[model samples]
Each structure stands twice: as structure tokens, then as C-alpha cells.
Target: MSTSLQVGKILNNNNRITSGEIMGSSREGGGRGAEEDEFLLQIPEASAKVPKDAFHLAYIFYFTLGAGFLLPWNAFITAVDYFTYLYPEVSVDRVFAVTYMLVCLLFLLFIIGWAHKSSAYLRINIGLALFVLSLLIVPLTDLLYVKGTRGLYSGYYITVAAVALSGVADALVQGGVIGSAGELPKRYMQATVAGTAASGVLVSVMRIITKAIYPQTANGLRSSANLYFSVSIVVMVICLVCYNMADRLPVIQYYRDLKMQAMNEESKEKGPLSGSAWRSTLWDIVGRVKWFGFGIFLIYVVTLSIFPGYITEDVQSLLLKDWYPILLIAGYNVFDLVGKSLTAIYLVDNANVAVAACIARLLFYPLFLGCLHGPTFFRTEIPVTVLTCLLGLTNGYLTSVLMILAPKVVPLQCAETAGIVIVLFLILGLAVGSVVAWFWVI
Candidate 1:
């Protein structure tokens, strides 16, 4: 059969699966049941038709826009103590911890709402609006607080709101509310990879910018808090505007109609999976896939231990010596961007998800460890530079593969919940890693 026919058949099979209909017989009836099971495992003909343009646009938004904000924020939190000249004597760790806790709570709330079948659109809009509002409030707090005492609280609040917004956005985009038009024509798996790459690029660029414009004071390090606050405010506003524009696009309605049609067809072919059954299935999948989660956790822990020790120290030293760190930062980001971008493209075009993930992990494990603890680690800065580049590459690939594969590992209805669980695990790993680093002085 032609590829199109094959795709159509697969889609039909998926529709059947979406409904509660079982394709194979029970094991109690051994011979026929075994035959049916073997038949069902065969690849179906129908496949999802993903649009190139829509997929590309989604990629740009996720990588260039969403990631642009997220990555810098991550790096910034890690180096906030060094940038305290912008705020003074405040415990950056405390602020970050509080913010992270709030974000986690908010994510839990979102998961609860989703489980109850609440309007994801409303939840997403409210979350994103609050996030932007918080960002706007940051610069204002700086303007108002002459003593700078309140700035810490303001920063913490903003960071919390930002993290909440990210979680909301992820849910919204994945659930087909906000980015549906951009996503409808694309394969969910490929879109995920693209999004991850975008995030990597964003982080790289933000770090570079921080290094370039970092203003040094007599205390210890250059303070880019104001720059971060200002840029974030601008980006938040831009995102709000873009979101509004997206809302107004006629394509959104079309996309929604198509999505509803798909859902309706799925519902008609097979009854919806019951809540209990879905929950059970989700847990079962998680149990089966625990190894992937553990691997990801290890990667995050490794990053937490090594990145802060090397990158922060390097940036601070350069700033103190009046050397521009932008070039290094840019180089790091470029490598990261390339790695993620390539990985994403490969996953989409080639469909070798497991292989891609393994490649990323293999590269990261040795490169990241060597960078932090290697003999020539900091000698002449060459090793540090190479490590940074490698870190960017490995992280970029790992993040992309993880995000892309996450939703696929479970039922479509549970994709958002899965993503949330993954995020929580990642955060926990980061916390544990940071503590270990602090205690061992590694």
C-alpha cells in the first residue's frame, strides 16, 4: 500500500484504540487470542499528517521565544548570589527555594484541575497573566525600594510567578489550547523535540547576554539583576501580545474544529477510557518506564553539581578582571542550540527516539564529569570552554529527547499530567544534587 494509505490505516487503528474496544481476545481462549494479539501488533497503515509550516512556527515560538525566557532564568537563579550587587545582602538561595516551592504547588494545583476536567484554557490564561504581572512588578519594586530590602521578596515572587507561567504554558500547549494552530499539523513527538531545542538556544543566548552586560561593583561580582528584570519584563509583554495575537488568529478556530473532530471520531469509535482505568494505566506505564525517569534524574543531578561550580566561578572571574564573557556565553549557546536542533530534526525525520536519547546521555555523562573534575579542567581556560560547549550540546539533546518521549510513553489523555510528574522529579533531583554539592564542596 501507498504511504498515505498506511497512514490512514494507522489513524483508524488509533481511533479504535482510543475507544474502549479491545482488539484481541482474552488469554482464557488461548489459540485465537494469541493470533489476534499478533495481528494487532502489526504496524497500521494510517499515520498522522503533520504540517511542515505549522511545525516550524511552533518550533520557533518554543525555542526562540519560550526557551529564550526559560533558560536565562535557570542560569540566573544558579548565579544569583554572584549578582547580588543589584540587590544587596539578600539570600538568593532562599528566594529561589521559596519561588520553586510556590511553582511546584501551582503545578500541583493545575494537575488537580486537569484531573477534574476543568477548563484548561482558563487555567492557562490566568497562570500566564499572573506570571507577566509578576515580571512587571519586579522592576517596579526596584524603583520603589531605595533600601533594596524589598527587592529580594519581589524577585522571589516574580520568579515563582514565572515558573508557574511556564508550567501553565506547557500544559496549555500540550493540551491543545494555546498553541493548537501551530501544533495541529505537526506530529506531537516532533513538536516536543523542537520545543526542547528552542529552550536550549534560549538559555545559551541569555547567559551570553548576562555575561556581556554584567555591571561590576566593588563587592564581588557583576550584577545583572536589573538587566534580567528589565529584559524579562519586555519578553513577558511581548509574549502577552503574541498570545493575544494567537487568540485572534482565524486559524486557531480551524485548528480547534479539527481537534474536536478528531476527538469526536475517537469517542465514537471507542468509548472514552474510564477515569479509574486511565489512572491505572498511567501508573502502570510509569512503573514500566521508571528507568527512563531515573536516568533523567541522574543527568539533572550531574548538571546541578557541576554547572554551578564551573560556570558561575568562570563568569565572576571574567567580570572581575574586566574581560567580556559574552563571546564564551555565545559560543556555549551556539553549540547547545546546534545539538538540540539536530537532535530534534533527527527525531522528527528519522524516528529513532531511543537512539537519539542514548547518544545524548552518552555524550553528557563523560563530558560534564570531565569538565568539572578533569586534570586540565580550569588550566588556561581551554578545558572550561570545551566543557561549557559540551555541556550545552549534551543538555540540549537530553532535554529535547526527554520532552519529546515523555508524552509518548503514556496515553494521550494523560500527557499533561505526565509532563508535570516529570517536572517534579527533575526539580527534586536538582535539589538533592545542589545539597550534595554544597556539603561535599565539589
Candidate 2:
């Protein structure tokens, strides 16, 4: 039995599963699904001759939007040198992780509850505007107040507030984009997921260029950090424009119309949408996809605890010096991109194996620890760098696989809410993992 089957069927009456959901998950990895030939009927959009994706514009837009949402986060974390210099007393990375993830998680819960009533369109537009504002905070603060000085503690608090603001923006954008993409085909979900890795890679590249061009001085770190936010701001503007225009695209609208049709049918059958009706439906959707959420939760709990925090703070290198963390981060980002993009070629259909892999990633904690406290050779740069890349690779692949699978488990109409629930679990994992990163001393 599949993991979903083993846990519990989504419906005993088989009313919830639709043809698109079946085909999306089943035809994966070239597996001929059970009795799929019998149910090879078309969903609403599929019933009509599917409109062309129009030079794959919708796909590219989604990919870019995926990349867009994470850029601010990457900017803040990758600017650790600047933040650390300004506030030497702080555990900069862990604190940022906690602040960002928790705020995002808390706001995400509210967004999920209010999601059916509000427009994701408005939420995303507001989010992109906030991203622009938050990305501007650090550089502007430094220019106006901090200068190149060290130990100005006021700057630290301002920076933390900016990080929290970015967290709120992330909750709005990530849930909306993922939820919207979930309403489409699985490949678009892969595009969105892969684009997330691309954001990491883009920031890493910026780190390389900035780290190389500037002299290794206090002034150099500040310049690099400002440059990071500057580029992020440009990307945010582009995303805002693109996302607003995305609603007009014929390909995107076709799917939106189909979802609306399904929703209307649902409303007609069940009467007007009341708060009570939504609450019951919300719980039902959550129950259907809880196992998938558990896997997503586990994935981030393992990843966030180790990455950026451990990669930047726990280890060191004589030759690489400050460059060591930059290079390690770059390597992880590259492999992460590779892993996320791999779903385009082949995906794991077996949920049992996918979830087990997430659990197996706990082994990374011991392996990374070995790099710090083990034998002389193991403590060297090569092993640590390799481990970091491996961490990124696993994190990317499993995240994409499970995200793509989660929405497919429910009926088409509930797919968007399922996606939002999965993202809530994702942020929840990040919040927990940030706390866990502190316990790394054990």
C-alpha cells in the first residue's frame, strides 16, 4: 500500500479523488497506476482542448515568483557578516531564524483561517510591496545611522524588526503562490519549488561577486551586504509587476476559471459559505493531508537546524577564513537547485520511501557533528563542504517531491487549502528547527 493508503484513505466513498489528482501522482516515475485506464476522464480545463501555455510564460512567471518570495530571506541571512559586525553580542543567524520563522508561522495560521474569504491576489500584491520595504531597511539604516561603525546596538534592533517584517511578507507570498500553483498541474508546483532554490543560488552568486570584489575589511562587508539588499529590491519590483500581470494571462486564467467553476458547484451543493461550514471543511482537508504535512514538517526541522546557522557559525577554516562560510553556502545553494530541478525528469511516487528519507536525514546531524569533533581528516574543509552540499541536495529534492504530492491527495477544490496547510507545516518546522539549532552543543 502507498503511504496515503496505509495511513488512511482520503475517502471511503471515493468521491474526493478526481482524475487530475490521480493522473498527477500516479503517472509519476512512469508507473501505470491501478485502474487508471478506467478513470482516464478529463477535468474541467482538460475537457476543453487545453489552451497553449503561451511560450511557457505562465511557467516562467511562476518560477520567477517562486524565486522572488525567498530573495529577501536570502538577503538577510547571507548578510550575516554585516549583522554580526553591527551586533557582536547576538547569535545573529539563530535569532534571525527564530524571529523570521515564528512570525511567519503565526501570521500563516491566521492567513490560512482567513484565506477562503480573502483574495490571494491582494495578499500577494501586499506581500511584494512589504518585501520591497523590508529589503530597503538594512542598507538605508546603515547609510543613515550605523555608518561603518561596529557595536552600535540600536542598529541591531532595527535590523531585527526588518527581519520580522520580512517574515510577515513571506507568509503572505509563500502560501498564496504555493496555493495558487497547487490549483494548477504538478509541474507548475515543481517550477515554484525549484525557483525557491534558485533564490538561494542567486544570493550565493551575489555573495561570491561581492566577497571577491571588496577588500576583506569592515567597509567591504557593509558594501557586500548593501549590494545584496539592492539586488533583492530590484527583483521585488519585477515580481510585483509580473504577478499583477499574471492574472491577465490566458493560461493562468483558464485554470482560475476552472477552480471557480468547481467552487461554484461546491457552493451550489452545500448552500452559502458560512464560517461554520468553512471550519468543518478546513478540518476535513487537514485530516486528509496530515501525513503529508508531517513529512514536510520533519524535512524543515532537520534542514533549518543545520543550514546557515551551523554552516556559518560552528565550523572554520584557516585558509578560507571569512570566505569559508560563503563558499560552503554557495555549494549548498547550487546542489539545492540541482535537487529541486530533478523532479522535472523523475519523481518518487512512493510516499513511504519519501517520508522515510525525510526521517533518515536525522543522520545528518551526527555526520555534521563529526566534522566538528571527530578525527583530524574529518574535521577538514573538504568533508564539511561535502556534507553541506549533501544537506542542500536532500533538502531540495524531498521538499519538492512532498509538496508536489500533498495537493494531489485531495479533491481539486480543496487543493489550494491543502497547499496552504502544507506551507503552515513548513514554517512550523522552520520555527522548531531554529530552536533546535541552539541545542547543537549536545
Q: How badly does each model clash, as a count of residue pairs? A: 12, 0
lDDT of each: 0.47, 0.83
- After TM-score superposition, the amount by which residue 427's alpha carbon in candidate 2 deviates from its true location, in angstroms, is 0.6
lDDT of 2 by residue, 1-442 (tens): 3322311233333446642554342232234344443443322223233356677777788899999999999999888877888788888988898899999999999998998888999999999999999999889999999997888888899999999999999999999999888888777899999999999999999989987899868989889998999999999999998888877887677667656655665665677666899999899889977887888899999888888778887889999897898899999999999999999889997778999999999899889888888999999998998999999999999999999888877777778888999999999998998898878742
RMSD of 2: 5.2
Give the Cα RMSD of candidate 1: 8.5
Worst 10 residues of 1 by lDDT: 19-28
Cα RMSD to the true fold for all candidates = 8.5, 5.2
Itemize residue pairs with steric clashes in candidate 2.
none
Angstrom error of the Cα, residue 268, model 2: value is: 1.3
lDDT of 2: 0.83
Predicted structure 1, TM vs. truth: 0.67
For lDDT, the strongest prediction is 2
